[model samples]
Target: MSKKKSFPLRLDPELYEILQKWAADDFRSVNSHIEFLLREAAKKAGRLKKSQE
Candidate 1:
């Protein structure tokens, strides 16, 4: 496994609540769900290399 970077992020309360529910529905933590969404987006946009996937 790779060492993960840590940083603080700010989100609107309403958005956070929505993400919280979505995360629960997916059986994931909010943090991991966000990362999964971003990774999928990057892959779709061809911004991520194959190795990165």
Candidate 2:
């Protein structure tokens, strides 16, 4: 694993609830779900280049 950093995150109430439910359904932590979403979105948006910081 690379060096890890922690940052405060803010989420919309409704959106966060949905993400929480989906994450539970998939048996993944909310953090993992968010990471998956970011990876996929980056791929689709053509921003997967330049090392996935």
Candidate 3:
């Protein structure tokens, strides 16, 4: 497994609420859902490196 980096994130209250609802709908924690979205976006842009899994 790769080491994961952590950082502080600030979101507008309304946006956070939306993300919470979406995450719940997808059966994912907000953090996982955000990472999923980011990974998908990176893949779509051809910017994701091949994983070592």
Give a tens-digit lDDT track for model 1, residues 1-53. Answer: 99999999999999999999999999999999999999999999999999999
What stretches of model 3 exceed 4 Å from their correct place? Answer: none
Looking at candidate 1, what is the lDDT of residue 13?
Answer: 99
Quality of model 2 by C-alpha lDDT: 0.89
Candidate of highest TM-score: 1
The local distance difference test score of model 1 is 0.98
Error of 2 at 51 (Å): 6.9
RMSD of each: 0.5, 2.4, 1.7
lDDT of 3 at 9: 96
- Runs of candidate 1 exceeding 4 Å displacement: none
Q: What tens-digit string does per-residue lDDT give for candidate 2 at 1-53?
A: 88766788999999999999999999999998998888899889998886874
lDDT of 3 by residue, 1-53 (tens): 67889999999999999999999999999999998888899988888888711
What TM-score goes with each of the models? 0.96, 0.76, 0.86
Identify the runs in model 2 with alpha carbons over 4 angstroms from their true place: 50-53
Candidate number achieving the greatest lDDT relative to the actual structure: 1
Q: Point out the higher-scoring one by lDDT: 1 or 3.
A: 1
